[model samples]
Target: MGLSMFALSRRSDARFAPARSSAELPPSFLGSGIRVRGVLEIEGELTIQGFVAGRIAALKLIIAPGGRVEGDIVAREVVVSGNLNGRIFAPNVTVEETAHIDGRIFHNTITVARGAHFDGRMPWRPVNFFETLDQLPETQP
Candidate 1:
């Protein structure tokens, strides 16, 4: 038995839009070599390839393979492929092969590669505390 052309054509549908150039994308780059002596706050996704010596807060943080940070980080998600020497607080944290971390980590999910060197205590915490509490039995006051 053989399949008909209509069977393959059925899977091809206009479900996705066309691609756009980098210029058409949103303002995402915070620029490389961002030396911040003070706090570096951001509301959107940020990719760092420089040296930071202060607090960093963003929606999503990406530490490039050549990036280095010497302060704390608070974000929704963090991807580290460089060097970090401070505490990290996020819901999801990933350490790639070139990553090196020497601090504590507080997150719901954490990934460490084989070549990654992380020498710190990772305190696991539930992501949904309210949901867990709601599932508990009601206690009489």
Candidate 2:
């Protein structure tokens, strides 16, 4: 996976702690009525309140309560409060109570709140795995 120059410039330490909090960065938002496809790569935070069907890479990713996503996700942190039907690759993952997930989650630390419906596998990876994850593996589904 290759990152944009901007993303490389903003790269953080191994722990994913940037100079500023994710909240401090202006997020890219997708409205509830919108739909998108293809690859999306962001250096900062991304909030999805719509429907997306593709791969996403970001520093932080948030799926709003009514959002829907289908594909692979790579981020430093991920918070899902909606629907997902694919894989998540992150160091820190939070499955909110309103979330519905299927597929797999690969993380160093994770939290799945009560009321969240998830029917998949959660694989634990060392923190260094994320720090050096330059490409996604083509593994078992």
What TM-score would each prediction reach against the true structure?
0.69, 0.83
Give the local distance difference test score of model 1: 0.69
lDDT of 1 at 52: 76
- Reference-based lDDT, each prediction: 0.69, 0.85
RMSD of each: 12.2, 4.7
Cα deviation at 69, candidate 2, in Å, is: 0.6
Best by lDDT: 2
* True-vs-predicted CA distance for residue 42, candidate 1, Å: 1.0
**Residues 3-88, candidate 1, lDDT per residue (tens digit)?**
66543432242111111122244425544656767777676677888877777776678889888888888766788998899988
lDDT of 2 by residue, 1-72 (tens): 355754554454535553245666788999999999988988788999999999888888999999999998
Number of the top TM-score candidate: 2
